[model samples]
Target: MDMEILKVDRLSFRYPEEDRATLDELSFTVKEGEFVVLCGPSGGGKTTLLRHLKRELAPVGTMDGSILYRGLPLAELAPETAAAEIGMVFQNPEAQIVMDTVWHELAFSMENLGLPPAVMRSRLAEICGLFGLEPLLYKPVHELSGGQKQLLNLASVLLLQPRVLLLDEPTSQLDPVAAREFIQLLHRLNEELSMTVIISEHRLEEVFPLADQVLLLSRGALQAAGGPREIVGRLGAGQAPAQLAYLPAASRLFLGLAPQAAAPPPGASPLTVREGKAWLRGLPAAGAGPAAAPHSAATAQPGAAARAGEAALLRCRELTFRYAKDGAEVLKKLTLSLYPGELLAIMGGNGAGKSTLLQLMAGLAKPQRGKVELGRDIHTGYLAQNPLLYFSQDTVAAELAQMAEYAGLSGEEAQREIARLLDIFQLQAVIDNHPHDISGGQQQQTALAMVLLLKPDILLLDEPTKGLDPEAKERFASTLQLLREQGVSIVLVTHDVEFAAEYASRCALLFDGAITAEGSPGDFFGSNYFYTTAVNRMVREWLPQVLTVKEAIQQWPDSGSRS
Candidate 1:
C-alpha cells in the first residue's frame, strides 16, 4: 500500500457557542495517490473536518483530536512547509480570491511564501500551462464567471505544487460541463501527477466513479468508509442511513429490481453513464427501441406557459443589460416574463447572463433599453447566490422574526409563522444559531425563509442550490412546488439540470446574451445532448425524451421493474 499522506485520529471539534461537537470522533486516512470523496448531509461537519487539515484555516473552536500530515503534527509544520505540502480549493472561490486579476492571484501565494523570483516564475509558467490559464492571465478576476473563478482557484493551489490537494465542493458554482472537465482534471492529477486528493461534495453521479474511496459523514460524525463500489453498493442495497444515502440512478434502479431477478455480477454496481448503459444492456430485450414519449402530459411552451392569456405578472421587453458602463453586454434584447404561479428554470453556461437576467427581472438592475414591468400589485423578491449577503441579523430566529414583523405579523402569530417556516426548511435545530455560524446550505434555507416571508407575487432565485446535498435539494424542490401551488411566480436561475427538469414547469436556455431556446422541461432537456440530466444521458437510447429517473422509469416500465 502507498504510504499514508494524511491521517485524522479521533478528531472532534466544536465552536464555543455550541454545546455539541461539530465533528465527533472522526477518523480517516488518505494514501499518497488516492482520490477520496467526502460526502454527506449538508450540515454534517464535512467542512469542519476539512478545516482541520490546514492549520492556518482551522476554526476558532474546541478541537480535541489530532490531524497529522506525513506523520507529523500539522500545527508544528512551518507555514511555508504546510503551504508547499498541502493545497486547498475552498467551497466558495470568492472567499479566498484577493488579487484584482488572474495573473496576480496565481502568484499571490508564492509571493507570500517569499519564493525566489526565478522559482516563482518557473512555477507560475508550469501551473498556467497545466490549467490552460495563459489566455486568462490578464483578465480581471471580477469579470470571470463562476467556473473560470473556480479554475483559477484550482490552478492557484497547483502552483504551490502540494502533494495533497483538498477541495470543498469545488464545483458548487460550476455548470455541468465545466464540472465534468474539472473532475476529469483531478483524475489526471491523481493518475499522472500522483497527487492525493480529497473532495467534499454532493453531486455523486460524476464524482462517485472517480473516487477510489468514499467517506460518509452525518451529524458531525463518520458513518462509513470504503471503496466506491463497496460503500455505494451498501447505500443502494439499503444498508445506510436515509440522510447519508445518495445513489446514482442506475444503482437505485439496480437495487429496485424485483427480489427474484438475477443479481448483478459481483462488484458490478454501475455508477456512471457508460457503466449504467452496459448494465442495462445485461437485462433481457433491452435493445434500443422507438424513443419514449413524454411521461407527463404536454405542457404549453415555457415562454407562453408563463403568460397564458393574462397580463404577465412580471415582464421584460427588449431588456439589454451590462455590468460596467463600458463592459460587454450581459444581456441583449432579452425579453422574458413570468405569470402567476408559474415556475421557470433558466440554465446556461457560466457568465451567460443567467444571473444578470434574474437581477433585471427582480428589479435589482435597470436595462439600457426597453423596460421591466411588474403587473399591478405584483411585489417582486430576489435571492442572490450567496445567502450571507441577505443576512443582517445575528441569529436565524431573529432574522426570521424580523422578516415576520416586516410582513405585518406579530407576537404569537409571528412566532407561529417563524416556527412553521423553520420546520418546513428543516432549520429548527439551528434556529438560535448565529446566521454566519450555520452551514452554507442552512444559511441558504434561512435566507429563502426570509424571502418567503415577504409574500411576494414574483420571486427570482439565482443558483439557490449552491451548497445543498441531494436530500436537501429534494426538499427545496418540494418547497418550490408548494410555493407554485400557492400562486407565487418563480424565475429560477441554476446550473442544476436535474432539479430544473424535476420541478420546473417551463425551462429556458440562455446563451450569448439571448434566450436560445424555451419550452417545457421535457422539450428543452430532451433535445439537449450536453446540458441535460444524468438520467437522460444514461438511458438516452431507449428513453431519449425522459429527463428524470421518475419519468424514465414511468416511460420504460419494464426497465426498473422487477421480473
Candidate 2:
C-alpha cells in the first residue's frame, strides 16, 4: 500500500449552536501521490470535513476525533507551520484573494511567510507558468474572468509546495470547457509533482476519470469509500442518488428507456463522453422506431401564432449592442420577443455571447443601436451568473430581508416570505449564517431566493443552475413552472441542454451573437448539427420528443402514454 500522508480518526464535529453533529464518526485516509474525490448531496458535511483537514474548525465545536499529518497530530502544529504544509484552494476565489493585482495576490502568502525575495520570484515564475497565468500576472483580480481567477487562486496555493492539496469545489464557478481543463491540469500536477489531491466537487463526470479513489458522504457520515470502478458500479446500479450517478450522456439515454442499460461490465466504469459514445455504439440498437422530429405539430405552420396579431410582453426591434470604444457589435441587429408566462431557454457554446444577450435584455448593458422595449407594468428581476456581486449583508437572512423591504413589504411579512423562500431552497437552517459562511451551492440558493422575493412578472436568469445538483435543478424547474402558472415569463441562459429540453417551452440557439435557430425545445434540439441534451440525443433513436429520463420512463410506450 502507498504511504499514508494523512488520516482522520473517529472524527466528529458540530457547530456551536447546532444540536446535531456536522461530521459524525467519519474516518478516512489519504495516500501520497493519490487523487481522491469527495462527493454527496448538498450540506452533507463535505465542507466540514475539509475544514477539519485544514485544522480551521473552531475548537469550541463538539469534537471526538483527531487528524494526523505524516503520523503527527495536526493540532500540535503551529498555525503558520500548518499553512505552509497544507495549501487550501477554497470554493470561492474572492474569499481567499487579498491583493488587487494577480501578481501581488500570488506573492501575498509567500511574502507573509517571509520567504526570500529571490526564492519568491523564482517560485512565482514557475507556478504561474504551470497555471498559464503569466499573461494575467499584472491584471487586476477584479478584471479577470471567473476561470482565470480560479487558476490564479490555485497558482498561489501551489507556490507553497504543499504535499497535499485540498480543493473544495474549485471549478464550481467555471464553464464546462474551463472545468475540464482545470482537472486535466491537476492530473498533470499529481503525476509530475507527486501531490496528493482531495477535491469535493459536483462536476464528477469531468473529474471521475482522473480520481484514484472516491469517497461518498451522507448526513455527516462516510457512507462508502472505494476505487472508481467500485463506486461507479454501485452508482450505475441506482444505489446512489440521481446526482452522484456518473453515467455519461449516452448511457443516460439508454438508461432512460431501459434502466438496465446503465449497468457496466464486471470491472469497468464509464465516466466520459468518449466512453459513453463507445458503450452506446457497442450496444444492440434494439427498441422502438425512431422518435418523430421535435415540434412536428407546430412546425407545419411556422408563424401561426405571430400571424394572429398578439402583442408581445417584451420586444427588441433590430437590437444591436457593443462595448464602449469596441467597434465590433456584441449583439447585431437581432430581433426577438418574450411573451408573458413563457419559459424561454437560450443555448450556445462558450464565447457565443449568450451572457451578453441576456445582459442586454436585463438592461445591465444598453444596446448600441436599435431598441429593447418592455411592456408597461411588467416587473423584472435579473439573476446574474455570479451572485457574489450582489452580496452586502453580514448574514443570509439579513440580505433576504433587505430585498423584501425594498419591494415595499412590511418587516413581518418580509420575514415570513424570507422564511418560506429559504425553505424552498433548502436554506432554512442556515438562514442566520454569514453570507460568506455558507458553501458555494448554498450561496447560489440564497441568490435565487433573493430574486424570487421580488415577485417579478418576468425573470431573467443567467446560468441559474450552473452549480446546482440534479435534485436542486429539478426543484428549480418546479419553481419556474409555478411562476409560469402565476403569469411570470422566464428568460434563461444556460449550457444545460438536458435541462432546457426538460423544462423550456421554447428554445433558441445563439451562435456568434445571433440566434441561429429558434423553436420549441424539441425542435431546437432535434437538429443534427446543433448541440443537444443527453437524453434527447439518446432517445432520438427511438422517441422524437423525449428530452428527460423521467419523461422517457414515465411515458414509454409500454407505460401506456404512447398514442
Q: What are the lDDT scores of the predictions, listed in order?
A: 0.82, 0.74
Runs in model 1 lying further than 4 Å from the true structure: 239-245, 258-265, 292-308, 559-563
lDDT of 2 by residue, 1-563 (tens): 68888988999988777766878998888889999998876778887788778876433578898889988999898888788878888777777888999999999999989999999999998887777778778877876645567788899888988888999888765655566688988898899989999998765766776788888887789877888767666666664546444444444444443435367554554455565545444544424445465454345224215533777888877778766565456677887778877898876665466777777788888887888899999878999878787789988878998889888888788888887787678887787777766666777889989988888888999878766766777788888998899899999988666677789888876666677677776666666333665555545656666666566656555543221
lDDT tens digits, residues 149-185, model 1? 9999999888888898999998888898988889999
TM-score of each: 0.94, 0.83
Clashes of 1: 1
Report the Cα lDDT for candidate 1.
Answer: 0.82
Count backbone clashes in candidate 2. 2
TM-score of 1: 0.94
